[model samples]
Target chain A: MKELWELFSVFFRIGAFTFGGGYAMLPIIQREVVEKRGWASDEEVIDYYAIGQSTPGIIAVNTATFIGYKKKGLIGAIFATLGMISPSLVIITIIASSFMHFKDNQTVQHAFAGIRVAVVALVVNAVVRMWKKSVKDLVGIILFILAFLVIAFTRISPIIIIFVSAATGILLSYRGAVKE
Target chain B: MIYLYLYFEYFKIGLFAIGGGLATIPFLQELIQKYGWVTSQELVDMIAISESTPGPIGVNMATYVGFQTAGIGGAVIATLGLVTPSVIVIVIIAHYFMRFAEEPLVKAGFYGLRPAVTGLIAAAGFEVARVSLFNLQEYLDTRKILDIFDLKAIVLFGILMFVTNKYKKHPIIYLIAAGVVGVIFKFG
Candidate 1:
């Protein structure tokens, strides 16, 4: 029980301080969960990250749940998810109540203007890393290009893209074009 | 009652957003357009705020949208709604992820998902870029152009890219540097 509480506290700190979303959260998770606690290995963290990305929902929440569940079980997942979200909930509430003009301030705007570019770069970093890991063959490469074009240029919904892509995978598997 | 609606709405967002938080963009755009809960400009502003602040952009956006529609209680509902599905699904998978961690079908599915998610993430990147770089007025007539894309942003992006490539450092270093630049250029 004490260990579980510790786990929750650690994750809470991570979720609290982490800005710019999942990619930004990675180093923190590595520090708390892997280096400080020795709860999981680097490989395990990477695996959890991969699974977290493939699954639905926020990557941070998904990652916390995976780690928490690995540590304990059902209860751990609950605690981790709560820990991940608690800061955002509290902070957002505080901002909502007191700071209606928060963004209007010049300092805040400038900071954000800087961060916005960083956000794009971070996203680009993620894409490059995933492309290196995921795209092995020509078919995967072609699908990658097609999906990028469809969403970038067209008004088609992303859900439809996911479905079509998944279906194409299933078909490719059936034809033995790709290996499991 | 309204809270429940907010919960279920974000639950849907949680269940369907395959490529993570950014994938929530198109869905949120649809919701804002369909419901008129918030204005388009507000949504853009929310993105700016969400991206610049802490936490997941989707969660922040959900909270903003909920607040716009229903206030504090709405924020809670929307947040819970967004996260609940992840909690449930991860718990269930955690129960079995070890036993089937190397299963072929599961591996195949994720392998396929890799390229697809890459595509989704790229799409998201481009969409945000479209909003950030290209002004609507600029498209209609070049004469009506605004300084939508700042040179500072480009320089920051280029330098960060160089730093990231040259030496592996924490993201905080880049964020801090950018924050300082923002203060000097925009704040000062």
Candidate 2:
């Protein structure tokens, strides 16, 4: 029980201080979990990170679950995961509730309009980065365009596109078209 | 009933959004169109706020949507919905990931997944960009090409796009800069 509390508190601090998401949380997690507490070694931390990134869901929560379980089993995983999310749960609720009250104010509305465009800029930046990282080969390029066009032009669900791409990737790998 | 629905829908998001916080945008866009719970502008605002504030964007977004729909209890449920899959899936992966880490199927799966997810995000970005920069309603009413563009928003988008690409600072910095510009310009 003491260890569980410790796990929660440690993750709570990491969750509270980190800005951005996924990759942003990695260094903080490394400092707290590896350097400070000695919960896991640097190499171990990197291994957890690899699994954390590939698996489904938020990377931070996934890493927390892996580490927590490594230390104290399933219950520990629950506590650590909860700790990581607790700050987000509290902070977003407060802001969301408050924003509703001020949403009608003219000044607030103008600020949001500007912020929205900035968000578009952010989205464009994200796409460029993702493209440079993921869409490397001809097969990847085809999938990228196909996925974008299908989702944008048709009402077909994004999930279908994802599954089809996964299958294509697997088939290509087996057929020796791609070594990855 | 609605609470359960929120949980289930977000659960789907958790299961599917394999990359990270930003990856959830496409799924959230689907919800926005299917359910009318939030507007396109509101979704953009949520992205800004979620990016600016601390914590994971996925969790923050889930909480925001939950609160908007069903209050504090709703926030908890939606958040749990989002993280539930992470806890379950990660626990399982931690046990066998060492062996599976080098497996070809796993590598190939992600090889394909990474690009498609990129495409999904790109599509979603196009949607966000369209909504932020265009005035579709006025264009529909007036049938004029000029009515399609919001010059103020377009200018801001252009300046921001240029500066952000060049500077490459934290998103919070850009968000604040844009907000101040909006307030000064009174774009609303």
Candidate 3:
């Protein structure tokens, strides 16, 4: 029970504080789950993130669920998932109720404008970090470039890109193994 | 009835919105067209608010749309709907597939997936930059090169990037600082 609560609170804090969504949440999650709590190792966290990205649903929520389940099973998963979203639930409720009044407020608009720009920076930071970790060889670089171009320019669904990339990975690895 | 509809609709969204939060936008666009729950303009506002605020964009947008259509209870149900599929799917994977982390096939798949995920994230970042730094729509309409860039936003972005790269402080600190600068400078 204590562990469950801890999981909840940690994810809750993560959900509450993170801006710019799942990718932006990565560093904080690394700090809390891997570095601070010692629940998972760095590699394990990356694996979870990789899985989280490929799976359906929000990457942050999926990651929290994965970590929670890893630590404490089904009940742990429920608590962690609940904790992760609780902040958003409350905050969004408050915003929804009063958003109309503030919709046109100059200060609010300006603040949001600023926040949006910062969010772009944060996402770019996430990309840099992810690139350093994930893009290691020619195959990885090729996949990265292809995925970026497809996603940025075309209307293709990301799920297709992910599945195609995974298949490409499997085939490439298999070929490399055979060659050796 | 409304609760069920919210649940059913968002359940589909959760089931299919692979990649991450922003991926759900296409589905939400469909919902707007089919249900007329919110206008296109309202959906745009919701996306802006969801992106700017804390929390995953998927969950935030779900809550916003739910609140608009059904109130607080609606918000709760909608969020639950969005997450339900995730919980179920993760549990199944946890139970059946956790041991496969060492499998060669799975490892290969993940190897490919890592870079793909990075690319997807890079694309997301690019999208954000386009929205924040460039007024693409306006430039498209007028063909004015000067109108394309938001000079102030670019400057702020550059400064924040340099600071973050140098110091590696918490992201929230940078976010708060940006918010403050935006208000002071009356950006946008």
Candidate 4:
């Protein structure tokens, strides 16, 4: 029960603090869950993200759920997932009720603009870190370049690229080209 | 009953919406078109607001729609419905992932997956950088290369890039500092 509450609060902080969603949440999760709590490993977080990105629902929510379940099973999953959504529920409901006009507020707009820019740096840092660790071989380099281009230039779903990359890995291992 | 119905719809969305927050957009568009949930213009507005907010964009949208439809209770239910699938699916997947972690096929798949995830995130970073640093519309209107640059934003981005690499501080500190600077500079 104590661990479950810890999961809830940790995820609550993650959901509340991180803006510019999607990849922006990655570094925060890494620091909070992996570094602080020792709840998950760096490799495990990456795996959760890989699975989270490919699966259904929001990646952020999916990640919290996976980590929560890993630590304490079904109830832990519920608490963490709830914690993840709590801020959104409160903030959005409050805004919807009376502060919808805040959308046009200049101060709020400027702050978000700054947050967005800083978010770029965050994502870049994490990407650079992962690149060093993950992109070690030629196949890794090729897959990295191809995935980057396909995602950046084309309209293909990331899921398809992920599947193709997985198939490439499997086929290479089977052919004695790469050892996993 | 209406709340339950709305919640069920969100549950279906959760079940089928692959990828992540942005992936839920198409389904949202369909809902707006089919049921006039919030109108096309409102959906666009919601998207803009949702993107800048602190939570998952999809969850924010769901809450907004729920609030508009049935107030706070609706918002809570819709949010719950959206995440329910994730908890169920991930729990099931984790169960199997652990069981299969040792299989060569799984390891090989992971070898590919890790890099691809990094690649996808790099692409996402490029997108955030484009939004934060470039003035696409201004460049289009002026037809000048220099018009594309937001000099202030670029300066902030550069400073942040340097400092973040040097200090290795928690992201929250950088976020707070940048937000304060943005407000002071009137980034808009």
DockQ of each: 0.47, 0.43, 0.66, 0.81
| RMSD values, in order shown | 4.9, 7.4, 2.9, 1.3
Worst 10 residues of 4 chain B by lDDT: B30-39
Candidate 1 lDDT over residue span A8-52, tens digit each? 887788766566666566656655787678988654664565567
For all candidates, what are the clash counts?
A: 0, 0, 0, 0
The whole-model lDDT of each prediction reads: 0.72, 0.79, 0.85, 0.87
lDDT of 4 by residue, B27-104 (tens): 888877777767788888788878888988889989988888788998998888899899999999988997898888
Q: Itemize residue pairs with steric clashes in candidate 3.
A: none
The ten-residue window of minimal lDDT in model 2 chain A covers A42-51
After superposing candidate 2, which stretches have Cα over 4 Å from the reference?
A: A1-88, A95-100, B1-78, B94-98
Which stretches of model 3 miss by more than 4 angstroms?
Answer: A41-46, A177-180, B1-5, B22-45, B141-144
Off by over 4 Å in 1: A1-60, B1-52, B61-78, B130-149
- What's model 2's lDDT at A25? 55
- CAPRI quality level assigned to candidate 1 from its DockQ score: acceptable
With candidate 1 superimposed using the best TM-score fit, by how many Å does residue B5's alpha carbon deviate from the native?
7.8
Which residue pairs does candidate 1 place in steric collision?
Answer: none
Best first by DockQ, ranked:
4, 3, 1, 2
lDDT of 2 by residue, B127-160 (tens): 7567668999989999999999989999999998
Give the runs in model 4 whose Cα sits over 4 Å from its true position: none
- Locate the minimum summed-lDDT window of 10 residues in model 1 chain A: A42-51
| Candidate 3 chain B superposition, TM-score | 0.81
